[model samples]
Target: MGFEELEPIFGELNVERAGEGSVPSRRFLYHVHAADPSHLRIIVTDFHSNAWEAVRSIVQLEDMRDNIGIGGSWLEFIDYVLASIKSQDAKLILEGGLDTVSGAANAKLVAQKSKGMPVISISLTELVGSAASAAITNLSLELFKAFKSIHDLYREEKELSNQLTKALAAEKERNENIQSQLEQYSKGKKLQKISSSDKADASALLNNGLENSPEKQTPRDTALTKVANRVVPVYRRARVRGVTLQDTEDIEDE
Candidate 1:
């Protein structure tokens, strides 16, 4: 589709066109910002004419734009874009027509670079024919919808994974707390048992002492009672002898 047709669909996006005269051929770049604040950059180029030369020019342009001085084969650009996507900074989609054998091979490499991003592949000759043009348009729309769906699903999956990790951590903490409380309770119960045993032993010793003390002192009490009985009879005899002991002796002699 022409820029006029795609403009309405992606008009809200931040658009930047590269390779007007600076580069050898024409190239367009569109940066789309989603509701989730995630960004997707789409690169449109034609490499069917001179694959190697076009690749070199594209790489140079990219290097200059990013100022990273990246050097390697053309396929390296795909790798760089994939790395950016993996880092979650932005998503990249490569769109081009596969006409020559080199273009097809490069397209395959580009598709492989993207782990899950969609590659929009179209035939250069197809645009000229009216029927093929309609089919391509439909195909483009379907691919865009599919890409959006996949991106949403990926975000949701990441969110769910994070939530599950937090839940697991919370559960582990709760279990640890419960185990600590149980240990404390067990210790308390053991201490109570020890205390009760001590009290029972003391009570048993006290009762044993009480039971044997009376038997141990009974002989001493009996001796004291006998001594008291003998003293009382002597005291009564002294009281009955009123006369002097000498006069009583003389009367007996006479």
Candidate 2:
């Protein structure tokens, strides 16, 4: 029941009175202690019980620690803490009978907030010398393990989400680059359209140029013309020689 005795089970413990004061009137005290910020214990007690029955509870507080300011309202803090606790799939161990006012209220609250969480109520007085301590130690360890499982799952989900986001961004960039290249290629490969008027103008220009140019004769025609010129001169010279011979023979006859 002693705070010092439970230190081994819940890490180094710290006790502080609730509310502010220059000599506060309220006797209510709440102990907030933990192994780390992620795992925390909050106990509210009047310190009137002869036995240390603070009903120590643990919760994951690291994620929301920054959001809850030092001067934040009590309701804001309570709402965040309740939300965080309900998210956990851990057990709630009550230290009394369900018929009791506090126990019944807690059970109903659990049912409303977290539907399937298991609740166990035990009488601390029934346990002799060290039974209560042993039970609480075991339960606290189990609760811590459950909280760890949830934390690990959340971390994995965040990492996977980040990777998926990066992949999608890269894919989008790649697709954009490909589209840009395709557009450039299409522009480069485009064939300019030639209008019918332009085509007809080009054809007329070509025909006119051919008509004005000098004509070129074939090789066979040039060869035949050269052969006829040489043969005609030789034939004329032979005819003149024959006539000279005939005139000489007539003179001899006379």
Candidate 3:
């Protein structure tokens, strides 16, 4: 692809076109410097008549200090690419064709890699022909839409998980409050039982004391008997001073 068309794809990235003599087999070599320390070099080969025929399509990574280094072989580079993708730390994407045998093999490797990350595959053959340019643009747009959908779904899942956690915590707190209330109610019932027992015991002791007393009288009964004895003598003296039955009989005889 021309620099003008590729510029929009790799915006703000440092892009350099390799000299024709640098890699004779490859038609175009695009060296792309990403924002991070790692860089990508995509090597595109001429299209063959047979789609299954092996094309010299290759991808090279530079200064990939965090990943394992590989040799110049296309297979080794594919392995390294997959390894980088699997590592989950890759910041750059180097899309290549999948029509040729080697390119198809690399696509299979990418497919076999673990998920939870995005992988975009673009065919170099489609980019060359004027008729296929529209298809390529559509494919790129679809890839972006897929990435955005995945991002939105991930955010939704995170929000649901957070809400579930909050609900569980609130349920636990409510259960704790209910448990505390139950415990307090149990303690209050126990105290009421103890108070009732104390009252019964006091009544029993008072009854026993009255039954064991010498006169079978409680303290209150004894005090009332003393008052009665003192008032009875006073009443008998007043009756005697008022009139005798013998004096009434003598008066009746006279």
lDDT of 1: 0.43
Q: TM-scores of all models?
A: 0.36, 0.32, 0.38
Clashes of 3: 0
Which stretches of model 3 miss by more than 4 angstroms?
A: 1-127, 131-135, 217-254
Tens-place lDDT per residue, model 1, 1-254, is 01221221221111111212122233322222221212222322232232110122343335443554446653464455444423422212223433322222322112222445433221122122444344335435755886788899999999999999999999999999999999999999999999999999999999889877856668778788678777557767888776456677798899
- Model 3: how far is 115 from its true place, Å? 20
Count of backbone collisions in candidate 2: 0
Which scores greater on lDDT, model 2 or model 3? 3
Q: Score candidate 3 by lDDT.
A: 0.42
The sequence of per-residue lDDT tens digits that candidate 3 reaches over residues 73-96 is 544555544453334322222234
Q: Pick out the ten consecutive residues of candidate 1 with the lowest summed lDDT.
A: 8-17
Tens-digit lDDT track of model 2 for 1-254? 12232232222112121122122222322223442423334433222321122232233222233433324554444444444333433222232343322321221111112554223121122222364355445445655776788899999999999999999999999999999999987776653234556778899998888765545556677788778777557888888878744577798899
Decoy 3 TM-score against native = 0.38
Ranking by lDDT: 1, 3, 2
C-alpha lDDT values of all predictions = 0.43, 0.42, 0.42
